[model samples]
Target: MTTTQPIGVAVIGAGMAGRAHLAGYRAASTMYDAGLPGIRLVAVADIHEPFARDAARRYGYQRAETDWRAIAEAPDIDAVSVVVANPLHREIVEGLLAAGKHVLCEKPLAPTVADAEAMVRAAERSGRVAATGFTLRRSPAINAVRRQVTEGPLGRVQHFNGHYWCDYGHNSDAPMSWRYRGGPGSGALSDIGSHLVDVGEYFCGPVRGVRGAVLSIQVPDRPVPLGAAVGHSAAVEVSTERRRVGNEDIATFTATFASGAVGTFSVSRIARGLANALGFEVFSEGGAATFDMSRPAEFTLADSAPPADSDGYRRVVVGPQHAYIAAGLPMDFPGVGHGQNDFFAWQARAFLEQIAGLDRLPHCPTLADGLHNLRVLDAIVSSATADGKAVTVQ
Candidate 1:
């Protein structure tokens, strides 16, 4: 009744995002293995050999290489996950596209807008499945909110309030790494703020312009690591060498959507006692809905119903009726909790469907979407630097 095809997959950059993508492929291969063909974890490439080898064994890859070009040119690899630094995205993506491999690149597409636009153009002409990792879109809560917005439970968006807060940079000795020094588009805005930007568009519509912004570095400088840095907090190799942080550690911005709905967004990497505490509340003429990633399993929503009492938020446990839940878990199992990796596996399934030429799945964010997000990040920076002056996105 259904057709299945084998796919060869490789992941570049064995860092955090790289590990997540590779593991997702493994989970999807087994969890959603109905008509899905077995995927070969062909290889993993990283700048560091230890990183590559470690990820390869941990993720069940067939091989590991220090050079990403090898994976790009590997004849056996049909699909690639570009999970490297933002500065390296455009070149690696275009190269992989030229080799005719389907690519799912990590978000904040590139360190600059021009590079992202170029990648978009390359993806357009390559005729391959090109996806960007705005992976949070796969969350069931996000999908539930989207359904409400489109189905009229929430009428027209009037205002959106969102925040992505983390305590990773609250420490004084945090080492400076690629994420901290990836030039203009790096830092809190592009790091976590990119997800907020994407979620904003998903909740309302495309933001037409930015009305104001305040971007600041919470920690003025961080100790430089002399050796290989690991994770968010790594000890410097016997040195107190420090470097100035070039980007904002926090960004607060106001945006106006094309439909004239206004919104405010705040992102902070130095918010103590919180890790990945991202959430949003949208107010529409019809009603309001709220979501928090910390909850992961449920969201609070309300409709414009006649109030007699009990007119507060309604807690929705993500079940089979919600998006992508049945694919990863038993929907009938009430009170079942979902985690972030579940979202990643679902995203992998979507990409597999994309490669299979199925149009019913959620369209993974394209290079164009990534570029638009970059523009929004850019406008926030511009607005912030100009002391909160409005900056229009073109």
Candidate 2:
């Protein structure tokens, strides 16, 4: 058998997520004794040259570039991580795939259904592995919930309820970024609702239809940055400017999965006092199971068949023995505890393995998943505009 060297990876963003991916790659390299069969960080790319250079130096990459195309077309680059803005996802991913590089893009896939569909076609034509950054699906605790649900422990899934609320964008003075904009898939829906949609589908199945509402509220006008504030050195009158905030800050939807399971989901960026509360509950004939991303280590499983005396939800502790756990790894390791679990490394390793022909493509959220999410998101938006009329997922 011929042994292949580690695949070369290029990350094309220097934002928070880009940093996380870099950290993940470095951690994986260390975990595998710097000898993982097929994966290595070869280059880092960002529009900010200094940030890219800094990341290269800190992450031990051999090269850094300001233009993503340089890394996308480099012969040494086998896979590209698209961590740029949502508007850039389709262009960069399409370009990388056209250049014959495998791609792992962050979520929402693209700003629209058409672009996301194009990305799917490109991946199909390239015959290269393509994965989305739906890291929550790989969580050990969530994996346990999936197993229990699939094993008939949850019985026939009848309903699902979920909330993904955070305060990161709650402050009125939160600076205006791509996330709060209208174009380029900005807004709370694509930014955070995408994850909740992915989570709902990952756990319940395909969402076949939706009925929901989307709303945006303003707390304050963000002050221009110091550099831009020189001309107008005062806080600009900031109100809930609906014209400036085009996308919904709050999204609530009721959906029916392909499996006939009904569900209700809510995602918000302005929920006061909530700091990253992504949670869900599955109710079935057998009982119910609940999960909260904030509390990464445990899930609640309620027994349906009870004598009524000891009937209650039991917390399941995800340990090293869990299906998603890597052998020889500690259960309480920082990565595992923080949801970076082996799953994060597994995503990179799995993509590398697929490219090397060592394994069939492992399921991560694919372009098809992105399409499904987009359709559902569209439905939710339409329903909201039409005053909560039920809308079928197209």
Candidate 3:
């Protein structure tokens, strides 16, 4: 049933990515032409008082909340975005779902597979619109490449190579926090590789197994923070005390897809000179395509139909005709650049649309898909633990 009344929405986190969710909800109504229900910016919540207050003021939320429990218990909130820490996801999400709120959770659904499984079951019981945040899939160029793979021209995908590199952990002076507390695949692999793995599966198919996996800890220890650390930025007053890092800074592995395609994935948070470098190359029987997240608006296609002399990758600049572009942008024209945060807006719109029952097929990944991603990541870590032996994705 289409929602007849405005959906009351609140965000439970007020930090970097949390702010993005706030903005996305604020802009979700303006992005598409669907007669979507109006969104009521009810509240913004954070443990830090200033963060919640600032976000509420900036995003036009009605009020600021210090506890997420307030959002869960509120009669006015119908939907909520849980953009908090991974370890806290299950508790917050379960609480919200039990309170009858539709949830949009951040990726790496939980710290472990058991937690993810529990979340999936909880979402199943709620019968609410529960989604995982895989915002990279909303990229117009990436979706265009996915179409080429599935809708012909590219033929059968043979190999997929993806890499997500960033410098968030490159500095030795960075403070230790929840980001460095996980084990094996929980580091860079889960941080960004989760998106890469999901994108690979979106293009080729489900990964069956993984081998030759390596998880490395470039910085063994980090300084303890004397103040609150926001997002990936280093803390300003880190104490002299250092803590041992419990997870890898880099992860690399080869994967076997169900479609008989082989793939490679490399992710690192300590890579030098690369900030938000998420890209992939797909080699198929008929053609090949490449997409770099650094250049979010276009992709390179090497179609095999051209003559031998003209056999080179052609740059395809995304336009209004591209996926999610026609009505997604204000101008909705060619060469109008969109960035990473725009993906969040599109994601918010799609989530709200699903809740409104305006679409048949799901536009975002479900909690089950998030569970599968965690399984694949667990398999990768298992492979690394077994001296790079092939581990089946269970």
Candidate number of the best TM-score = 3
Question: Which 10 successive residues of model 1 have the least lDDT summed?
Answer: 229-238
TM-scores of all candidate predictions against the true structure: 0.95, 0.89, 0.98
Native-structure RMSD, model 1: 2.1
Local accuracy of candidate 2 as per-residue lDDT tens digits, 1-394:
1237667888998766787777666655444323346567789998878778888898788889999999877998887778888888998999998998888898888888899999999989988878888877767777788777888577667888888998776766645555666642257778888888887887788888887564555543453333211111223343443335556677777888989999888888888888778999988877889998878877889876677898998887777655545442444443455465455665665556556656432556677777778888888777777888888889
- lDDT string for model 1 (36-81, tens) is 6668889999988998999999989999999878987889898899
How many residue pairs collide in each prediction?
0, 2, 0
Task: Give the candidate order by descending TM-score.
Answer: 3, 1, 2
Per-residue lDDT tens digits for candidate 3, residues 1-46, read 3576899999998989999999999999997675888889999999
- Global lDDT of each candidate: 0.85, 0.74, 0.91
Could you tell me the lDDT of residue 324 within candidate 1? 75
Alpha-carbon shift of residue 203 in model 1 (angstroms)? 1.2
Off by over 4 Å in 2: 1-3, 30-36, 183-185, 226-243, 304-307, 328-343
Considering only N, C-alpha and C atoms within 3 Å, which residue pairs clash in candidate 1? none
- Measured with C-alpha atoms, the lDDT of residue 79 in candidate 1 is 87
